[model samples]
Target chain A: MEYLLDGFADGLMRVLRADPQVMLAAWVTIKVGFWATILASLIGLPVGFLLAMGRFRGRGFAITLLQTSLGLPTVVIGLLAYGFLSRRGPLGFADLLFTPSAIVIGLVVLAVPLVAVFSMTSVASVDERVRETALTLGASNGLVAWTVLREARFGMMAAVLAAFGRVSSEVGIAMMLGGNIEGYTRTLTTAIALESMKGEFGFGIALGVVLLAIIFVTNLLSRYIQRS
Target chain B: MEVFFLDNVKFRFETDLVLDIERVTVSSGEVVLLTGANGSGKTTLLRVMAGLLTPEGGVIRYKGEPIIFGKPGLEHRRKVTLLAQEPYLFRGNVLLNVSYGPRARGMNISQANEEAEEAIIKTRCEGLIHRDAAKLSGGEKKRVALARALAAGAETLLLDEPISHLDEENSKLIVEIIKELAASGITLVVSTHIPEWASTLSVKNVRLAYGRVV
Candidate 1:
């Protein structure tokens, strides 16, 4: 118990002192998580909006498929991405395996369904009268769609924050896809895993603290947006 | 001039027939009052007239040009606006809500504000101009919604249950506003459940019973 307390104190000191390795891992994590979340939002928001508003054959099937994807394990995504990005694989020409970009690819796969499902819920919750009101006010179809999206803006933001939270904290994809390469592809989650396994509990705890802070900040922003 | 001519128009909700008018006409600059009991299809008829709903089968002519059932042109929409029974104000201040119609029609912000202010004054909602629309009382929301429709400058207005839940003073104010609107030669089709309310306005009455003109 004393040793654990010492390790916790050492972790706090290292974080306060801005240790170089911890800082580099944090920066890489932010960069990869940011890019993955942005790419996923760009693809997911519109797809979710269409799924919520559009009426067509097989819409129910598409929603079911999206919901199922939300529960997919991150390691499975990492494995699939590895297969596609590995040398002698379909995307081997890009030579992106064991790199930060590879990790980003995996994280994007893990985050898209989350963003899409949340966005669909947000848009679907808007009052049906909004569409009718816009139409009666002489707004074109495009304008009506824009109006609905604006009304659902906070929910869309929450979706983005939720995606960021998921991608930032996930370890499976970071480890399998990034190979935990130091000074290059290393991320906070991967570093935490590697450090703890190598008996570097202080360093692992420091990175864990940073990861928790990132997730905490995201949740705070989401709650603030929802209240506003 | 006949502003709207509906012939054999039919509308349904799933399998339930809602509006089935054999014939109806509204001449330009006329006030047509639609009075009906609950579920008598008054709101549905107004929605069809405003080109917001497509009738299952019918020929609707606007200004002598045929309005295709499902494809009411933008021009048709711009010239006709509907005020719902429970109007929805956008999430913004009253000025922004009232200016939405003018903005949607491509007016610049300043010009739209000018139109909105004029309409707001006319509807006696100038005091609520800077107030958030979502914070408005029920009567205020209705008046602000009317101001929005007015700012659109449409030649025709379709109001559904305009005085349904208003206090006596507010109801009187709305009736006076309707009179003023008619005097200005804007075609009006106002719906109400009370037959006595229709008598307050010099309007031609169209009574509905179970989706048909009685």
Candidate 2:
């Protein structure tokens, strides 16, 4: 137990060294998370608002499905993505399976439902008075929606952050779809798993610590943002 | 030059009739004070004038043509604005909050600033122009609401409980401004429980009770 504790601390110190390999992993995580978040927001937030506010035939069902998808299993998502990207599947000519692109695609798929559901919930929570006041003031449709989003801006931000957090630390999709290729598709989580299997306890422990700290900081940021 | 007409207009909220106004005419440059007990459709009538609610029956006319309740409504939206009971200020500074409508209507940034500044000065809220609109005091928010309405270049203003949080001095100042605006051909409709606001203008008093115009 003492040896294990010593090993864990030393591994954390090693991972915190900011060397090229660790830095590379960190850079990839940031890049992937940022891109996934941007794409999710662009595609999901507006659609979610429309789904909540706009009258449509299947709105209720769509909202329910999105709500249910919020708790979707990551491993099941990985399987679905793998099946679609594998040979003999849809557009298999592009050969995206086991690539970083495949990992990103899986992450985005996992994220959109969360973004959409949270955005819808947030838009629904805005005061109805805001829309009525805007209409009474002669604000156009665009302005009305604009005012709602601005008033509920914090909720939209939460949706974005929540989606980012969901995708950033997810390992199942990364491992299955990315194949955890060294120096390429290998993410922090995937690398931790691989190093642990190879009995490189220090590297695995270090990566785990970084991931935990990131999750903690993200939670703190979300709290601070919601408060302000 | 009656700017608004409610000929036997009726409005229902859920199943209850909220407004049953008959033959109410608001002539141009006239200040009409709406007085009523609480839940007497004061706000509802104000909302009808502002085009926020559709009357169950009858028609409201602006400038002799009927209001169709479209995106732009009957009034020139660029020049007609309403300040509701609790003004919904956007997430921004006072200057931006005041300038939004004008800017959206194609006013240049500098022109919007000038217009917003003029409006802020008009409402004596210039001191709060650089302050955050979302965190303003109640009276300050009320004043900012007036400035924002004025910023729309509206020749007609419908104010609901505009003076609710104001002290006597500021209310008097606001009344004077309304009178001056009336003299300059701006139509005004102010709804309040207090009666004295009617005496300040070339005004006609209308009483609403239990959703009916009396």
Candidate 3:
């Protein structure tokens, strides 16, 4: 108990002093989470809108595929990405194996289905009249869709926050694809995993605190958006 | 001259027939009243005419040209506006709701604002222009919605039960506004259950029973 308390205190000190390695890992973690979430939204929002609004055949099958993808294991995504990015693989010409970009690719695969499914549900829940009213008011079909999406923006932001939370803390993709290279691809979650395994409790605890803080701020922002 | 005509119209919901009007025609700058009891499909007919609901089978022609449902429907839809029985306001203030139509049609900000303010005055909702639309009372919301429709400046207006559930004062206000709008030469199609109030206006009447013109 005494050792644990001493280690926690030392972790707080390291976090406060902004250790270079710890800061680098934090930056990488944030970069992966942010880029993955942005890419996911870019792909997810339009797909979600079409799923909710367009009258297309096989939509149910598409929706089922998205929902199933939501539960896909992170390591499975990492392995699939690794398979393509590996030297002997089809995409080897890009030379992106075991890099931060590989981790971002893995995280994006994990986040897209999550964001798309949540956004579809959110946009679907809006009242049908909102779209009708916009249409009656001379808004084009694109403008009508824009109107509905705008009305459900709080819910969409919630989807983004959920996506960010998911990718930021997940360890499987980071460990498998990032290779946890120091000063390059090292991220907070992988660092914590390595430090704890090596019994460097103070270092692991500090990284954990940083991770928690990022999630905390993200959730706080989502709440503010929702309430507003 | 005929503004539009629906010929051989048929609309159904699942196995239930909602509308089966053989033919209906409206001229430019005319006032037409749709009156029927509950579930008589007055609302459905208005929606179909507004192009909000596509009939299972029909051809709607505007000035002797066909209005196709997929892309050409937009041209007809832009010229016709529908005000639902239940008022729905967007996320912002009353001014935003009123200005939505003009802004959506590509009007500049100053032009949209001018039209919105004029509509607020016309609807007698001047004081409510800056208030949050979502927080307004039902009657207030209805008035704001009317202002929005009027500000749109569509050639044809479809109003569903515009004065059905309001107080006498509000009903009188809406009736006067409707009369004014009709006198200004804008085509009006109003749906209401109360025949007594509708009888006061000199307009062509169409009564429906079970989705068919009677």
**Which candidate achieves the best TM-score against the true structure?**
1
Q: How far is candidate 2 from the true structure (C-alpha RMSD, Å)?
A: 2.0
Sort the predicted structures by lDDT, highest score first.
1, 3, 2
Candidate 3's residue-wise lDDT over B59-121, tens digit each?
Answer: 777667776553347787778899999967899999999999999889998999999999999
Model 1 DockQ reads 0.73
Worst 10 residues of 2 chain A by lDDT: A18-27
Of 1 and 2, which scores higher on TM-score?
A: 1
TM-score of chain A of 3: 0.97
What TM value does model 2 have? Answer: 0.94
Model 1: per-residue Cα lDDT over B1-214, one tens digit each: 9999999999999999998999999999999989889999999999888887888998888899876433346778888999999999998899999999999999999999999999999999989999999999888899999999999889999999998899888887787787889889899998988767556567888999999999
DockQ score, prediction 3: 0.67
Question: What is residue A42's positional error in candidate 1, in angstroms?
Answer: 0.9
Candidate 3 Cα misplacement greater than 4 A, ranges: B4-8, B22-25, B57-67
- Clashes counted in candidate 2 amount to 0
Q: Write the per-residue lDDT of candidate 1 for residues A96-141, one digit (tens) a residue.
A: 9989999999999999899999999999999999988888888888
Q: Which ten residues in a row have the lowest lDDT in candidate 3 chain B?
A: B63-72
Query: Candidate 2 residues A1-228, lDDT tens each?
Result: 886887688776886676555556655666677787788889889888898789999999988888888788989999999989999879578999887788888898889998888888889989887787566555778888888888878888888898888788989999999898777788888888888899877777777777777777877887777887
Q: Which candidate comes out best when scored by DockQ?
A: 1
lDDT on C-alpha atoms for all candidate structures: 0.91, 0.80, 0.89
Each prediction's DockQ against the real complex: 0.73, 0.46, 0.67
